[model samples]
Target: MFDLLIQYEWMRNALYAGVIIGFISPLVGVYLVVRRLSLIADALAHVTLSGVAAGLLMQKEVAWFQGVNPLYTGMFFSLAGSMFVEKVRSLYRSYQELAIPILLSGGIGLGVVLISAADGFNVDIAGYLFGSILAVDEGELTLIAGIGILVVLFFLFFYKEMFALSFDEEHAVLTGISRKIINLLFMLVVALVIAASIRVVGILLVSALMTIPVAASLQFTNSFRQTLIWSVVFSQLAVFSGLFAAYYLDWASGGTIVLVSVAILLLILAVKRIVRIFRRNPVS
Candidate 1:
C-alpha cells in the first residue's frame, strides 16, 4: 500500500493534499466550533459546488476555458459566498444565524441549475461531490499547499484575538479587538479551507473534516491549546486511515474519511462512558 505513493504520482499528490487539509481544517475548525459557527462551512461548501458547476459548463462551451481548473472557480465562489454571508449577517443583527441557511439554500439551488445546464458531466461532477483520490493533480496540490500556508499564517498572527473572540465576543470587543475585520478575514479563511479540501473530501463532506475532529478533541481537552493539538492529531489519523480504506476497499474517499472521524468520536464517547461507570463502582 505504501508502495503506491512512490509508484503513482496521483497517489503522492492525494497524500500531500490530504495531510495539509487534515491539519488545517481542524486548526480553523476549533474556533468555528467554539463560536457555534460550524454551519458556515457547510454553506460555503454548497456555494463552491455552484462555482465548480459553472466551470464545468464553461469548459464544455468555451474553448479558452478548456484548460482552466474547476477548483479555481470553486475557490472564487467560496470566497464570494463568505463575503455575502458576512454582509447578510450584518443586515440581520438580531437574526444573524439566518445568514447560513439562506446562503446554503441559494447555493444548492444555483449549483443544481448550473449542473443541469452543463449536462453529461455526471462522472466528473461525482468526483467533486464525493471525492476521488485520483482527481487530485500536481496543480491542485500546489494550490492546496499555498492555501495551507496562508491559513497557518492567519492563525499564528491572530491567535490571541481569535481566541478571545471565540470565548467571549463582548469582552474581546471591549478589549479593542476588531470584530468586524477579524470575522471577515476568518470567513475568507474558512472558504479557502473548504475549496482546498474539496478534492480530498468533496464539497458535500468537507465540513465533516473541519468539525468532527474538533468534536472528538473536545471530549477530553481542558484547554484551548490542547483542543487544537488533539484535533490535528485525530484529523491526521482519520485522513491516513480513511485513504487506506478507500484505496483497498474501493469506497468513496469522502464518505470513508467522514465515517472514520465519526468512528473516532463514538469510540471516545464509549471510553468516557465506561470510565464514568468504573469511577462510580470502583474495585470492591
Candidate 2:
C-alpha cells in the first residue's frame, strides 16, 4: 500500500495535501472547539460548497477566458461565509448560534439551486461535497502548503490573544484584546484551512478532521497546550493511515480520513473508561 503511493504523482500529491490539511484543520479547530465554535466549521464547509457551485456556474459562460479552480471558488465562498457569520453573530449579540443555521441553510440552498440549474455539469460537484483524493495535483498541493504555513504563522503571532478569546471572550475584551478583531481573524483562518482542505477531506467530512482530535485529546489532557499537542498527533495518525487505506482500497480519502479519526476517538474513549474502572479497584 505504501509503495503504491510513491509510484504515482496523484497519490503523492494527495498524501502531501492530506498531511497539510490534517495539520491545518485541527490547529485552528482546537481553538474553535474550545470556544464552542465546533458547528462553525461545518457551516463554513457548506458555504465553501456554495462557492464551488457558484464558481462552476460561472465556468459555463467564461470557460474561454478564466481558468477556474474549484478550490479557489471554495475559498472565496468560505471566506464570504466567514464574514457573514461574524456579522450575523455581532448583529444577534444575544444568540450567536443563530448564525449557524442561517448560513448553513443559505449555503446549501444556493448550492442546490446552482447545481440544479447547471444540470450539475459545471464541476465535479461531488468532489466538493465528498472530497476527491485523486483530483489533487501539484498546483493544488502548492496552494495547500501556502495556506498551511500562513495558518501556522497566524497562530504563532496571536497565540495569547486567541487563548484569551477562547477561554473567555469577556475577559479578552476587558483586557482590551479586541475580541472582535481576533474573532474575525479566527474566522478567516478557519475559512483558509477549510478551503485548503476541501480537496482531501471534502465539505461533508472536513469538520470531522477539525473536531475529532480535539474531542479525543480532551479526554486525557486538561491543559490547553497538551490538548493541542495530542490533537496534532491524532490528526497526523488519521491522515496518514487514511491516505494509505484509500490508496490500497480505492476508497474516498475524505471518508477514510474521517472514519479513521472516529475510530481513534472511540478507542481513546474506551481506554479511558477501562482505566477509570481499573483505578476504582485494582486487583492485587
Candidate 3:
C-alpha cells in the first residue's frame, strides 16, 4: 500500500481526500452530537444522494450535464435540504425531530426515482453508495479539500458561538448571538461537510464518519474542548488504518472505514466499563 502510494496518483488522492474527511466530519460532528441532531447528518446525506442520482441521470440524458460533476449538484441539494430541515423544525416546534424522518424518506424516494429513471443503478452510483478508491479522482480531492478548508475556517471564526449554541441555545440567544443567522449558516456548514464527505465514505455511511469518533471520545472525556480534540484523534486514526486495510485487503473502503470506527467505539465502551468496575473495587 505504501508502495502504491508512491506509484499511483489515485492512491494519493484517496488518502488525501480521506484524511480531510476524517478530520472535518468529526469536527462538525461534535456539535451535532452535542446538539442532539446527529440524525440530521443522515437526512442531509440522503438528500445529497438524491442530488447525486439527479446528476447521474442528467449525465445520461442531458448533453450539458455530462460535463457537470455530480458533487456540485449534491452540494446544492444538501444545502437546500438543510434549509428545509430548519423550516420544517420551526413549523413543528413541538416535534423538531420530525424533520429528520420526513427529509430522509423524501430524499430516499427522490433518489430511487431518479436512479431508476437513469436505467437502474450503475457502478457509478454504487460507488457513491459504498465508496470507491477509483472514484476519488483529482477533481473530487480538490473539491472536498476546498470544502474542508471552508468548514475549518467557519469553526475558527465561530467556535464560541457554536459552542454556546450547542450547549444552550437559550443562553446563546441571551448573550445576543444572532440565533437566526448563526443557525442558518451552521446548517450550510453541515451541508458542505456532508457533501464533501460522501465521496470517500459514501452517502450510506458518511454519517458514521461524522458520529462514531465523537461517540468514542465521549467515553473518555467530559470537557467539550477535550471531546473535540479527541474526536479528531480517533477520526484520523480510523481513516489511516481503514485506508491501509482497504488498500491491502481489497475491502470496500467505506465499509472498512465505518467498521473500524465501530470497533473503536465498542472498545471504548468496554474500557469505560472496566474502569468503572476497577474504580468501584479499588486496586489491591
Highest TM-score against the true fold, candidate? 1
Q: What is the C-alpha RMSD of each candidate to the true structure, in Å?
A: 1.2, 1.5, 1.3
lDDT of 1 by residue, 1-284 (tens): 67998898888888899899999999999998988889999999999999998888888899999899999999999999999999998899888889889889999999999888776674468889888755688999999999999999999999999999998999999999999999999999999999999999998898998899999999999999999999999999989887887788888888988999999999999999999999999988
Better of 1 and 2 by TM-score: 1
Which 10-residue window of candidate 2 scores lowest in summed lDDT?
A: 61-70
| Candidate 2 global CA lDDT score | 0.87
- Each candidate structure's TM-score, on Cα atoms with residue i matched to residue i, is 0.97, 0.96, 0.96
Error of 3 at 120 (Å): 2.6
Residue 109, candidate 2: how far off, in angstroms?
0.6
Which pairs clash in model 1?
A: none
Q: What is the C-alpha lDDT of each candidate?
A: 0.91, 0.87, 0.89
Model 1: how far residue 245 lies from native, Å: 1.2
Candidate 3 structure quality by residue, lDDT tens digits, 76-95: 99999999999998999999
User: Where does candidate 2 stray beyond 4 Å?
Assistant: 1-6, 64-66
The predicted structure with the larger lDDT, 1 or 3, is 1
lDDT of 2 by residue, 15-46 (tens): 88888888888889899898888999999999
